[model samples]
Target: MQNAGDWTRRLREIGIYAVIGAFLTIISPYNGSGNLPLWGAYLYWTGLVLTGSLSAEATRTLMERTGRKFGVPVMLALMSVTSALAVTAMIILLEALTSGRSIPPGYLPRLFGLVWVIAAAVTAVGIMIERTVLAPVTEPVKGASPEETFLSRLPVKYRTAELYAVSAEDHYLRIHTSHGEELILMRLADAMRELAGADGLQVHRSWWVAKSAVRDTRKQGSKLSLVLPSGKEAPVSRTFQAEVKAAGLSA
Candidate 1:
């Protein structure tokens, strides 16, 4: 499934570059040499796209190690540098392979132009690559858990999601899912670390819920209850009210 997605994204990206390259061809003083060289350039662009998809996993690993979120901007910057370096290596290798020619040493003008053009093409590809590979995981979040945010372990399947909320029998968390809630021997903070790509917020000391599951927000005196979309009311303390509001959790 991922391979198909990657290929589909790559094809779309190639079409975009093809259109741009066509415009450049029209603008440049073209005499001959059909699409051979252009196709070669296209191949190089594909390499950058693959680099981006490959980087997505590595960047997720980086986030795990640093305990930080791998946002879009950071991912783009990393891929830009990576693609640029890869293009440079390709150019050097190509030059070495064709080194038997007696070409003039003072080809500075064309060399500089070629370098920038290739770099620009690779950078364009890098951006697209980052988008496809990182979109699902790096998407903006409505809220973050206080103990440990879901952004820590990204691009990985959470063994159990339906049970993201609910408390264990005692001193532990119970993740309630369609498959049924599971008793996890951990703290609210510790257990919150296992959740991502779900809705809900930590209203009180022990509750985390899916925002979509929230049916209504009701207040009585100074307290609140997050009425789950399922009709279950989870208490919301004053201390966590600000967070609840920030999640845009409707009342």
Candidate 2:
């Protein structure tokens, strides 16, 4: 089932890029490339767009793995720069191979600028699609536990254990449960979607706690944290403190 979902997401992403590629082909932005035959132009833009998109995706994944949060605009800027560099290199190589000529050093910067524009546009579109089209449906399944979907991702021994909280550790998530704790390779953002049906709210950028698992609230100076059964504490960031209080977890 997980594999199926992954494939569906990949196909949708490819479709979105293909549409953008087609649009670029029609417009023919570059003066030299605009003179190419229709078929050749289509192939050129589509291939480049797909390659650039993949490069951007890889950059985004790498950034996420570093465990440092970035605002949307900053993230997009980083991805665009990385993708532009990769695509620019690809373009230079292809031109040299096909035309037996190297792009002049002075012209390389301009070529990168053009590629950056396309990369930024594609990155923005991909982010929008992820937030809208590919976001997980939060509705509960009929006749099933609210946490069923999320629990399914746990190891067999932990599947039936009551979920306590989840904390981010680099590119992995440390799952705390009634039985014990375990680690899984998944992003906190993606885990939140799977955990939507569970009775929990994100208490911090890196922590999500099940209301039932929060035994008490801990305060140190102006900071707040949620104490769980196993003596583990999940810090509640100022950003989410209001939500935690409103949910009665901070009481």
Candidate 3:
């Protein structure tokens, strides 16, 4: 369900970019001095914008996975550099393929600097639009508790999800929600603390299981596993056996 919402939102963003690209195509910026026809210029700019948007999204996702949180200045610097390189490469390829003309290597440095300025300007416009126009209206209620607000740290898809469990995976947490599962860069101890509002317990050093999601308990060989409503099993460590048993999962 949430996955479908994510896809829908992504498609909408792409559509919005396409519309902007079409308008930029009509304006034909930087094309007046070029030899390409109006239609050719439209195609080139539209493709460039689409590709640039994809590259930006990819960069953001990579940063999230690697837990790279940059300040505004650093973020802007990175975006400017990345956009310039990506957009310049795209334009070079398009020009080479369509007009059989390649930009001289010697001119690339100057071209990159110019494109970086334009990319930075465009990024500013994007930020303004996001803050003033595209921002969602679902703000937190006036009296919402901090515990309830804890979900805000989760990805948009899981923000309102019923959390089932959070398992530690190195520095990342494998979050299990009623709808699905997702990985986030967070510590298990920290996640457990934030999840204090939920009726759950730590069954092992690496695993936290929601009490409501526990369907049963079963012994497999020398290990004990807590069965979830989804039929998935969460292992219980020997150190937590007594506590887990006391929680009424002896079956």
Best of the candidates, TM-score: 2
lDDT of 1 by residue, 1-251 (tens): 56764676567756755654565445432221224476655444454344433544464456557644344446455645444455445545545555543324476445435545544455545444443443333223356442124332222334323333454345545554433333333566754555533455566777877666666778888878877544567887789888888888744
Best by lDDT: 2
Query: Which of the predicted structures, 2 or 3, would earn the higher TM-score when compared with the native?
Result: 2
lDDT of 3 by residue, 83-200 (tens): 7689889878877876799889998898788767767766655544543344333344567543345555556766777767778877667767665666555678877776666677
**Candidate 1 local distance difference test against the native:** 0.51
- The TM-score between candidate 1 and the true structure equals 0.37
What local distance difference test score does each model get?
Answer: 0.51, 0.80, 0.69
Q: What is the lDDT of candidate 2?
A: 0.80
As for model 3, its CA RMSD to the true structure in angstroms is 10.8
Clashing residue pair totals per candidate (backbone < 3 A): 12, 0, 0
Candidate 2: regions farther than 4 A off: 1-4, 137-144, 148-209, 213-215, 218-251
lDDT by residue (1-251, candidate 2, tens digit) is 56875688778877887788789888776643546788887787888887887888898779766755566678789999998898888878878877788889999889899889888988887776775576444455677675665765554666688889999988667888887776565789988987777789999999999999999888999999999998999999999999998998766
In model 3, which regions exceed 4 Å deviation? 1-8, 32-37, 130-154, 157-251
After superposing candidate 1 on the true structure, give the runs of residues whose Cα lies further than 4 Å from its correct spot. 1-66, 100-154, 158-251
- All candidates: CA RMSD in angstroms? 13.2, 7.2, 10.8
